[model samples]
Target: MNTIEVKNLNFYYGNFQALKDIGIAFQEKIITALIGPSGCGKSTLLRCLNRMNDLIEGVKISGEVDFKDKNIYSKNIDVVELRRHVGMVFQRPNPFPLSVFDNVVYGLKVHGVTQAFRLEEIVERSLKATGLWDEMKDKLNSIATELPLEQQQRLCMARLVAIEPEVILMDEPCSALDPIATAKIEELMFELKKKYTIVIVTHNMQQAARVSDCCGFMLLGELIEFGTTSKIFTSPDNQKTQDYITGRFG
Candidate 1:
């Protein structure tokens, strides 16, 4: 089942077009990776899914972005609730400057979850889901920024999980981590796909191949190709995809 679908989507920042007639569907409970060079609109397209671009000044969009079969850009749609359902993780760790416990429960608190016992339960469960429970259990009061970068990233994920988001959007989530930490994040993505739909914008071709079931290759402001990761890597139907994947050009 497709959880989200984009049709003839176009986005503009002021007078400059950032995306052009893009269309794609993200399968339910699977990982989809968008790969392209910097400034190719990969991240812009990712932000479109959750309407994150709305926060930018003078940003305009034309087209349909259907989430769970409803147009997200509709006048009656609640942007705040839309964002609650589609969580986003940025290129950097970006943990809140609060304690570990507060960071994990931040989302819950925002959404009006105030019971002490319930908050504790959510913190433990979210941390465990991201494989950070043991590491953070004894230091719940420590400042989130004081943790290692990798741990900070995991805490960000945990915060998202506490809110029970349906889709998780990651933009170069591992760009700041070491190889070992990157591997761990990749492993976590696999586990995450069993329950939540994931869409990632990544520059690392290998990471896309290893972690995503479906891959989309973007160039300039358009999607050049999208297909199963195996076919996209081994036998792409588009020359642009082949060139980008084979190191001919990006």
Candidate 2:
């Protein structure tokens, strides 16, 4: 079933339009990748899913972004609670400059999870979900920033999982990692998708093909085509999608 739906969506930055009348539905417990060249509004659309764009000054958005059948842009919605249900992971690993344990339990604490036992349970579960528990269990007290980039990225995912979000938004999540690390993260994505709806904005076409069940191709602030990953990569109906996929142009 669809977990989030966007209909007639438009977004602007001051005077310039960034997203043009976009429409798409993200299915639950699956990976959806948005792929395009730089500055095509893929990231802008990703931010819109959870109203992250509201943080920018002079930004305006219209149309409906429905999460669980409710329009997220509606005035009655609580941005904080919406964000809790739809968590985001940035392009880079952004672990807090705290201990590993602290980083994993940070969100839980923020939402009033004060019981020590509950926090510990979540920390263990989250780390294991991200495949970090075995490696990180002994180093819980170590500073998060001191870990390797791969571990830091995994820790960020663990942090998000700790909050038990229903949907996960990843913006170029593997851009900073090495090939081996990227592979590991892709494997983790597969595992995570069994429980959460995942939307990723990626510049890497191959990564999108390998990890996403469905894919959307965007260019110049418009989504040119969206379909199953197999169809989009092999037999796309749109010439633009075919060209982009074949590397004829991006």
Candidate 3:
């Protein structure tokens, strides 16, 4: 089933239109990758899924981004609560300058989950879910920023999972990691998709192909094509998608 749907979505940064009449549906408990060259609005559309664009001044958006059958752009929506259900992991590992335990419990603390036992339970479960518990259990008190790049990235994912979000948005989540680390994160993505609906904006076509069940190709602020990853990679109906996939042009 579809967890989120974008219909005729448009976005503008001041006078420049960033997303143009986009439409796509993200399925539940699966990985959906949006791939494109830089500045093609892939990130913009990712931000729109949880109203992250609202933070920017002079930005305008129209059309519907429906999460669980309700339009997220509707005036009645609570953006903070919306964000809780649709969490985001940025392009870089952005673990706060805090201890690993603190980072894992940060969102829960924000939402007023103060019971020590509950917090500990969540921390353990979240870290285990991201395959970090064995490595991090002894180091919960260690400063998060002091960890290796891969661990930090996994910690960031742990932080998000702690909040129990229904959908996770990852913006080039493995861009900063080495090949081995990237492979680990891709494996984690497979495990994560068994629980949360995942939407990733990736510049790496190969990464998208490896991790996503479905893929969308965007260019010049438009979604040129979207389909099953196998079809998009091997037999895309659109020439633009075929060209982009074949590296003829990006």
Candidate 4:
């Protein structure tokens, strides 16, 4: 059931250690929420799964992050292929300045898929999967930025789905949206877990409680506790986790 595993992981942004000896295994096709205060390596650890930290200058990572039995950090590993298996969605809705149709199909195009009918099928399915198809079905060729911000975020999800990744990583995905938009996205997150193993970082404790089956709490670059959401919120083994969940301290 462990689809992704990390062991003895350590990461540094030029000697400033961001994560320290972090290890956890994610169950397949379930929602796992990573929660903690800001700058606790929640997002940094999320990025490490798929090697996004490689983009930062002077960054060095030392870890064994295995996805489907392969060490993602191995020298023979292909980052592009690794990313294709593990897709990430950012905090903001960053749809490119192109038609909605193009935005979703862009990934397919990059991988040398150019058949018009097949591309259209993927675009429709991706949009539908994110619940954007009914709304944007009639305006496929219109500029993507013209849509409401909520729809735009869903479009970003559609863009991620177009590639058919096995895992989806969301970093504070609903932080920028209003409560209503956030609720919709939360619902979408619930729906998405049936198909993909989702790892989400959230500032909203309630959101994490509602959506995630399992939860991990991190602090000061260390994993404090990880368990079922019910146990983590109600009766955590770690004092830090209890304090955090109760709002006594963060």
Which residues of candidate 4, in runs, are more than 4 Å off? none
What pairs collide in candidate 3? none
TM-score: model 4 vs. ground truth: 0.98
Candidate 2 C-alpha lDDT tens digits along 1-250: 9999999999999989999999999999999999998999999999999999999999989999999999999999999999999999998899999999999999999999989999999999999999999999999999999999999999999999999999999999999999999999999999999999999999999999999999999999999999999999989999988888899987
Q: Give the alpha carbon lDDT tens digit for every residue of 1-250 in model 3.
A: 9999999999999999999999999999999999999999999999999988888999998899999999999999999999999999988899999999999999999999999999999999999999999999999999999999999999999999999999999999999999999999999999999889999999999999999999999998999999999999999999989898899986
C-alpha RMSD between model 3 and the true structure: 0.7
Show the colliding residue pairs in model 4.
none
Give Cα-based local distance difference scores for all models: 0.95, 0.96, 0.95, 0.93
Root-mean-square deviation (CA) per prediction: 0.6, 0.6, 0.7, 0.8
Residue 83 error for model 3, in Å? 0.5
Worst 10 residues of 3 by lDDT: 241-250
For each candidate in turn, the TM-score is 0.99, 0.99, 0.99, 0.98
Q: Against the correct fold, how does model 2 do in TM-score?
A: 0.99
Question: Which run of 10 residues does model 1 get worst, by summed lDDT?
Answer: 241-250
lDDT score, candidate 2: 0.96
Model 2 scores worst on lDDT over the 10 consecutive residues at 241-250
